[model samples]
Target: MANRRASERRPSDRRASGLSSRRPSIDPWRLVPMDKTVHIGGSDDFNVLFIGAGNIMFGSDEGPWNHSFRFEHKLGRRLKVVALIDPAIERATAVLQKKCDSFVVSAYQDTRVFKTLEDFVKNMAPKDRPRAVIVGSPPMFRGSLAPGRDIEMQILKFFPGVAMFIEKPIATGPKSEIQDAFTIAKTIQDSKTICSVGYMLRYLKATQMMKHIIDENNLTVMATIARYACAYESIAKPDWWDKSKSAGPIVEQGTHFCDLSRYFGGEVDMSTVNAHSLEWDENAGALSKMAVDESKIAPENRIPRVTSATWKYDSGAVGSFTHVVSLQGTNYSCELEVYADGYMLKLVDPYVQPTLYIRKPGDDNEQMVRFPDDDPFFSEVSNLIDIIEDIEEDPEAAQILSSYEDAVRTYELTWAIREASERSREAAKLKAAAAA
Candidate 1:
């Protein structure tokens, strides 16, 4: 039924893109089948060409930034990584050379993918041909330092032969830019070139737990609060994380909250929003040496060390988001609180060993705690690889993952919040002038 709904709603242009290749028999229940010596799903297996080599999109500092690497690691020789990045970073380039079986360092922001493909296709090398390209760039950036049109053009060009394992908060811009990215992503949705976004939190252990809870209890989402914190300081952010380049804090950082909001409450159209900031950070940076505290967080993402916002979803659910560099909070933390029928589910610290505290009549004193973990990041990456495997086997299974279109919804939401915040500031200035 989910697949049918997706197929019925997809555009005619999108339906025409993927391949209906000869199948080699695999369990349809399992989306993408990876390499496992132990008997399980099916005997069939395949490879994929991944194009992202960024931090959150793939994995973290340890390498294999996100699930794509896990996919490759799990499938062994069957899964291939194709790396792409702003600069040919040693890690990405080295991984491509040694780790990923076949990789490309081409810039999706500058190079024309379609034109290059035409030339590459004309080449006489037998081994040069790739199975399918997975676009991991475009999204998963802190800013828009690069060009969007170029990226969109590249994705559109490669739509026919590529399956995308994109990141969440699909775009980083205002309404216009977000809309443009949406149109471009929409232009390429075919069966073979499956579209999937990195809303990895959707696969969280707590989230999975909540899915059952919500269904079993028949809870209508009344109030949902998804909070994520990046209290670290950085020396320099990626060029894209720069607000001027990326459109500001909301689009870049606040997007996780947006994605999580959508996950918990379904398609949310922000009904009301209020956003503000505590300090003009660059001023604080220049004016005070005291700003240099022990908070030696990642520098690049220092656009807003402290930020907060609130909104109401179309599903009649209210929510709030707070991002602060407070020394009090943990290094990286996320929590979601859902209120239904006076019973509350507070899920805290995800992408790790998650802890769930149920608030009800017989609850255990209603306390807040953290989720401990060992290699939690690996699980997120593994899930994404599973999605990628599904796309490779049967194009139909590919639709199960988050789509760029869905991601754009949150991007637009952030854009609106930023604009609203700015407008409120302007209104305050006008009122002050009038009194003066």
Candidate 2:
């Protein structure tokens, strides 16, 4: 996780510290273009590795963001992809050969594809080991490389303090699974690993600008509200509907807002949160003794289609989060709003076509700010490269937002909300049985 302010710096000192006055000088109409060519680098360039070879890496961008594609567009030949590890060696090789083109393969030649991470790490010389790693594997496979060891722990075993960039929804559902993630998070903190999670939205220029405004104005945030409602018709996989594999929409898709809430509102108290869920039913649309089959889904992933939850942050700020995946067609919405002293901010669609809206408190009029070349996915890779360069210069030069330890708390908040809904459903079932 990230600590934005030092302990010695009081909240009241923020406005006077001059840090808030340094606002981002970004033009709304400026179009930032991604470079098509990779900059050539010498043999002593930074070496990196990729742990997964699926859609997030090789597939086409569904909307406007794809991790591997963005990295290639930005970093190019400046870095070397020393190895790519996946269970299916053929798939990994195909992804590289087909998706990467000849130029990329030529720029990074020592890319030895391996069937497993164990094989790659064992075979490579200590000097040849990667200085950084990108983990794009699915949530269920997160902690499964070994029997009980989590992905972070396993990686730390071989390479302590390695710069790691892990994908989000840090872990799958179930309280025990969350606890496992929590343990690993603590371990990561203890080891002081240079790590960052794939909460790429936080890397958006628009988000940074909003944070700047909040700090500059010394606004006392009252509440942060977030909503994510999307149509599932375009989703290609059935397991996405099956709660077991995908962790439903909340953990799978809507986690961005949950993390944003913590970003603006500060740390949360699990005991101060409560949630309620709604599902479709036949008779009077009333909840039944068993309206849904919990067995059909994994215990960790049995999230409802619609959920509303509220929590109180340690800073005395109140927050709310809502998620829905029942819409049809191509309509979808994902955004977060902050109600602070004198001004309110609305950050819209950080994944693609990000924009920010600022309004005077109690006023209806709002001003829209947009960026043509705001590539958050690319920005995230750029940050990683910066960390790599920092480490190359000095091992302690790396500082990042959205680190793995920070992301685990977001995962915990989602799990707590799901658990609260589960408890409510069970109580309804008991009441129904008593009436019968």
Candidate 3:
């Protein structure tokens, strides 16, 4: 079915469909009402520092939905990019010259590029320090177990209390590295630093509406079913196909859904998690039929074609997620369904056009709410700025939905799912060996 836009809907049609024409107001963390009386950062310049110049920070040829570029467009002349720290300094320079227009280039004329964070820190004066820092480095370069090696630790230590916006999959490495990365959460908490993980979906209008409905009805969530089917065939990165580098699809890609599931179901019981996957093989019903060549990589290192996982939330609610890496082109099939006693809430196509479907008690038909041209990335960054601006006036002025500590839990859950699926694969192999 084609998604209908809110602008296209007539006032009478919205009333008949039980849809409100009014936009949902942004609530502070914990559903607290926002105080409009407090003055946010006005026309003053908002200085920001970037840790990486990759696609997440600056838009690549693949897409133009990057955070740095979006923030520049949003803030205009008031946004000051103090500097960018990256090993490949040329990449940042290229992005400024090629991807951006004259206005952006002129605004960022003073933006410097450094080969490393240490270099940038040494040269930059305290007066030029940014109030906000965005870390968009590769997963492997983020949260490190070693002191001075982690981006988060360095920022907190040097620029005390600076607001941070770290990209998703916070860290990717072996089991030891992931566990070590978890330790950074406490440092962020103790320092009282305002940090937000890049789980932009939580900022979506449809997601907020879903939460509003669930809260209004005082519904007990029974289950959350989510599916993420990506366009793996079009993936060009070699590291992405390798489990060792990318932490497999579940940890790397499907984490968005896993985080969302936790968002609705509350804390998850790690012990209750179990998972299974469809391995790639020449046999029928195997992932080999997809036509992607994975013969070069060993079976153990290659990512699963499909992963199915289930877990129980601390609320006693069950949840299940399925991730499939078998779609063509960029049309990813993603959706989440939440079931309560007598209501069902389904959010679909979050990446492009987000549409929420609601079916309440005694209603055989589902009501659809379309959020067109909704950019969660922009919302997340804009909200972060608001928090940074108003934090001095009221410590509780703004709330970060996905804080560093909260994101660690989601990271642990994804790792648990990956571990469970590997165990299942090993068990199947042992059974076949015994039969042979």
Candidate 4:
């Protein structure tokens, strides 16, 4: 009886009740069953081309400093090394073979060798083109100042929009080369290319935590102090001893701290930078004590034993960095400290197990946080890959802290420091002459 009564009701009564006669549409794809045997959530193949195969790419006899071993370890089976470009192909081959035999097995076995980048670009098919390139070549071979020697511009010409990982001390020839390297910054920015300079310390978890604390407290950084003491006695490379080739210790090895100082403080005022260096002297007891032969490169061409540099940041904060090449064995001492009102943050032993010591307002003692298993090398490479794939989830972690443009600024600051030290040395010589 109720059904008959409802059927008797007018269509206007159903419309007033807000009832729809049409059924909701269902997606046809959702009806299909997913195969259980197929693997899910795996990434695709990532091909990488390497421009150099030296200690920076494969690592040194001592450890994995500026090494690409972490790249393979992080990507696992997904990484494919397409080719290596180097004049000394045999060195690269041998190093990769040793790495595969001793370390984890990688796809290096199928990597082809090319004497030059031009040869690789001309010969390789479009399907086999690398999605990313790692330029680990020497400083002399990079930058635009030298017309025929710029590896970066050549790569961009051949493979536009390819992700790049360029190691630091971008170019090491003369002042002109550094200036030329700076010009590429505009090109990189214009192309919207994804580039990361090899300042891996910025990717450290401890560094991110420090940044987090700074932001949380809205702290105003007053100053940054950094020191890098290297184990110079263990350095056996002939080129490294030559100031012309390696651009001195301050530009080559000490750049890490200089870059970090800028990271903590903002952009540096180039005109305000000043520095002093301790030159190697045979008569001086401190300079003559090193195991390295000082006479090989002549006194003028040899790198300084120590360099202390200071600069003013754009934010009016002052920063200082001192690099000393006076240590024995493989233990290198490195640390950076940031200061603000009622706050102090110090990061020690950045290369190895990095630890952060923090002191806050009204705290009785400083708190210590240690990161033992943090591999920033792996993190930097992983972040680059994530960026290339457009799969980066965390906005903070996805940032490329050191871009090519930013590194050029650091390079400029390092050169300025070296020049300031040179001026100081020259002034000292004139003062001695006047006394005589």
Judging by lDDT against the true structure, name the best candidate. Answer: 3
* TM-score head-to-head 1 vs 2, winner: 2
* Model 4 RMSD, rounded to 1 decimal: 15.9
Q: For each candidate, what TM-score against the reference?
A: 0.70, 0.83, 0.87, 0.87
Q: Across residues 21-81, which tens digit of lDDT does each residue of candidate 2 receive?
A: 2222222222134553343234465667888888776665456546666666555665668
Ten residues in a row with the worst lDDT in model 1? 18-27
Point out where model 4 deviates above 4 Å.
1-43, 98-106, 282-285, 288-291
Regions of model 1 farther than 4 Å from truth: 1-45, 56-64, 81-92, 97-132, 138-156, 159-161, 189-192, 238-241, 281-305, 328-330, 361-401
Of 2 and 3, the candidate ranking higher by TM-score: 3
- For candidate 4, write residues 1-436 as lDDT tens digits: 3466866875445333322211111121111111211211257767889989887887767766645666665566667788888899889778667756754555676678899999998889766689899999887788664665788898889999998999887877787667677778888889999998888888777777776676556665778999999887778777887888888988888888888888777788899999988887623326534555767786779888889988887667889999988888788999999987688999999898889999998995999998776766766776676678776464543557788988988888889999999999899989999999
State the C-alpha lDDT per candidate. Answer: 0.52, 0.70, 0.78, 0.77
lDDT of 4 at 398: 54
Worst 10 residues of 3 by lDDT: 30-39
Please identify model 2 stretches exceeding 4 Å from their true place: 1-43, 107-109, 143-149, 280-303, 361-364, 391-399
Candidate 3: which stretches are off by over 4 Å? 1-41, 61-64, 99-101, 147-149, 282-293, 391-398
Clashes per candidate (backbone, < 3 Å): 23, 3, 0, 0
Q: Which ten contiguous residues of candidate 2 have the minimum total lDDT?
A: 22-31
RMSD of each: 10.0, 6.4, 9.0, 15.9
lDDT of 1 at 7: 47
Kindly report which residue pairs in candidate 4 clash with one another.
Answer: none
